[model samples]
Target: MPRWFNTAGPCRADHHYMLPALRRLPEVLPLIGQESYFVLHAPRQVGKTTALRALAEELTASGRYAALHVSCEEGEAAGDDFAEAQRAILSRIRRSAEIYLPAELHPPPFPPSPDISLLGTALAAWARVCPRPLVLFFDEIDALRGQSLLNVLRQLRSGYSDRPTAFPASVVLCGLRDVRDYKVTTDSRGHLGTSSPFNIKVESLTLRNFTRDEVEELYQQHTHDTGQVFLPEAIDRAFYWTQGQPWLVNALARQMVEKLVPDRGQALTAAHVDAAKEILLRRQDTHLDSLAERLREPRVRRILEPLLAGLALGEVPADDLRFVQDLGLVRLAPAGGLEVANPLYREVIPRVLANTAFASLPPQSITWLRADGRLDTERLMEAFLAFWRQHGQPLLGTAPYHEIAPHLVLMAFLHRVANGGGTLEREYAIGTGRMDLCLRHGPDTLALELKVWRDGEKDPLEDGLVQLDGYLAGLGLDSGWLVIFDRRTGQPPIAERTRAVAATTSTGRRVTVVRA
Candidate 1:
């Protein structure tokens, strides 16, 4: 295969991609007959459409099922016009079938208009005429809006019973969100939020990112085809940076192969992957741009602020959760908790928000302590308290990322200190209450947890002490400092709130205080 550098799916010249989802077809194929309506949702560009398309093609080739891939995105603009939307769907089905299927598998007639009743009629006609079972893979099902969405689902539900010989045996709805997250309504008078056309879904299936082993295998495929081996650290960097997001994984590799090392003669190392990450982030490519774009939404801000402070969101509405998850900003873990969906996302968010922070820091001025090395908690806190005494009020109120502003600024300071020599790893997502930042400077590690307290709380002193103790205890460290930002406090003089290092907690552990 030749080298591929353009945007889009696997190109003909370079088709070395071996997606694990495709390899698991044997497992997924049998489930289709048993499950009437299945859903496959994930963050954008994770190969949800590609995987289903491949499945549909394989099923059609088996001579047992006549599979068709139809996109609902084009018709979604119809809003509440169910009939027009249905016609659009049918037209897409006709076109897709013609393109993918052999010329002998003649296309069906797509009527000019299809109401709920006519949709069933048209589907039944196809099922009755076709020799094999009908399977419809509805791509971008979530794109359908208002009643157009409701009409399609209800039509599918109505025709579901007429299976095997009369209608599609199985239907797969693939999009950025699960079927359960779909909000459909038909109020031509106005718009609808949650009140109109509530939840109506059977179950949902989420497409997962490539696992660590799968990531390694995917990288090896590139090496096998191109002979540009990825060093162990490079593999680790790729997995850590992308968390195996399909497009990111491929794109990162492509950047390293074509842009970073066009000759393809040099071995790609972890540093190379790191360099590629810097380039991608600096350029702010479409993938990263789209992810960052949603941050402006109030819903996104509401959920993300608490998260950046290292707090857990108590209870969130299903819609908001689905919205964030769909954006690929976060994901629900197998352990039933929420986390940033992948590392690429985790790294990109802060970078986009604070571009000058890391770049301006002088790498040579900072020093990292080893594992046995100790940090002057009291001194650091004292310095910050002094700094806060002067600039705290003005900066806090003026911060762009208002909710998590303090945390972001604090991180900026530490990032400046640890610039060239240390690592800053963070875990904060929309809906996750607090942000947990782990800063490793050579051997010594500082775990700083941030929280935004509500009004009437002059001192979250009690709560802050308790949480910091727990965080320190988790790391089996008897010492660490906790910085609390009283968002409720009016901008007061920094001198009035200067730094104090007091041994506060039941353990008599020293906790440095920087009141900003």
Candidate 2:
């Protein structure tokens, strides 16, 4: 059977086009060799489970250790009940050991005890009787919560010194976060911030996304198997869109090969990859949906809100930034700042946030289209001005994020225009101090820059025009729009303030300045 790209679960060599899992996790072997307990963390679906499971099998096959990959996820349902959680975890470990380890290495049954804290004792007994030094990979360790989580970490820490002979040597705790970010509490009081119960963790290593070369190598597997080749430009486009995110890289390839263009005779081009990206964003597949659901989280909002609005992220807690990074919603930008992890996410974030507003919009006529079906720039601007006068304020409130309310409202209106087969692309980031929009309607391309005019600040028209000029230059256009949203106190109503005027940028580009 030919291997295919995998999106849903752990990648199996027999079924999926995959890279060497162990190569992605270089820190594991050295840590195991030194008999150290460590944490392996990364965003969901980035192959943490696959990597650890492969390591376990390889270690056991070497005949030097009894290694098993066990999950603590079942214990999540137990909540704060330490006894129930402990039982669920131990049962999972026993079942996993029976399947993955040799008969002689299978852990003996746990000693019957009422004390939930005896998990360490049970492990000690198993190690003492096992034929070899034991190595264990505990997956989903962060799924335990409240007292259950605290108890498990403390129990593991209690057995730290008894490794190799009395307890598992070189244990690994695997989850979406490092040990420092685990939420643990000793009593009914709120979270014990940053205080890890499992302080014995030697290091917290994160699994990184694939590099450009890795992305190409994985795609090449499909070509080698079935004779369907992805063109060089398509490969470059895929890397640019996904930033080597594993699931996204695979999903885009799957959508293009298996669904979009299944004919093996046709070469996949850059255009095919771009179309696949749009389909994935519109469909909001399980992975993207999971990411969208996290938008409601406070920490997620703290970073993403200002990011979308193109406002300065001032005074944000360091942990919040780190948390967002761990979730894979943002990354350290190559330009020395944080940005949405990839172009695909940059598009998804606003669309997901504007979904409600998109639905609430009244039906609009395509008055901006010329007789030849081309978009008329002036007519489009006039229509937007009229729409802003009528329903902009109300629609702004419909957005889930407040900082980007105006931006969302405008995007919702543009989405209505693009509904007729045009495309709207957005660009915003920290320190940008503005949001740039590019609308492509048939042969027409319009560039727009949006800036807010607050009470204490001067009018942003000069800066907006300058920025829009640069944006237009990049797109090889000679004209665009600079929209200044007057958000200052004591301003006239939106209807009264909304208007457009002709202006010229310092770079000699003609610009239509809209104030609303």
Backbone clashes under 3 angstroms, per model: 13, 0
- The C-alpha lDDT values of all candidates are 0.67, 0.88
Which residue runs of candidate 1 sit more than 4 Å off their true CA positions? 3-7, 10-16, 24-27, 111-118, 185-203, 296-302, 322-327, 332-337, 352-402, 409-484, 490-514
Candidate 2 per-residue lDDT, tens place, 264-366, comes to 9999999899889988988999999989998977878989998887788999988888888998999998768889999999999898998999999877787
Candidate 2 segments exceeding 4 Å error: 185-192
lDDT of 1 by residue, 1-516 (tens): 454433475323235566544663344566676745666677777776677777777788988778877788888878888888877887787788789976655446743443666577788778877877788888888788877887777777777778867777777777776665564653222223331132333445666677778878877777877787888889888998888787788778878888888665689998788778766765778878878877766656656655555556756666676678777887776787667777767767775555443343233322333245555444445555555565555555544467676666666666654554556666665443456666765666777666566576456667767877787887777766666666665755556755555556777766665555
Model 2, residue pairs in steric clash: none
Q: What is every candidate's alpha-carbon RMSD to the true fold? A: 6.1, 2.0
Number of the top-ranking candidate, with lDDT as the measure: 2
Models 1 onward score TM values of: 0.75, 0.96
Worst 10 residues of 1 by lDDT: 187-196
* Best model per TM-score: 2
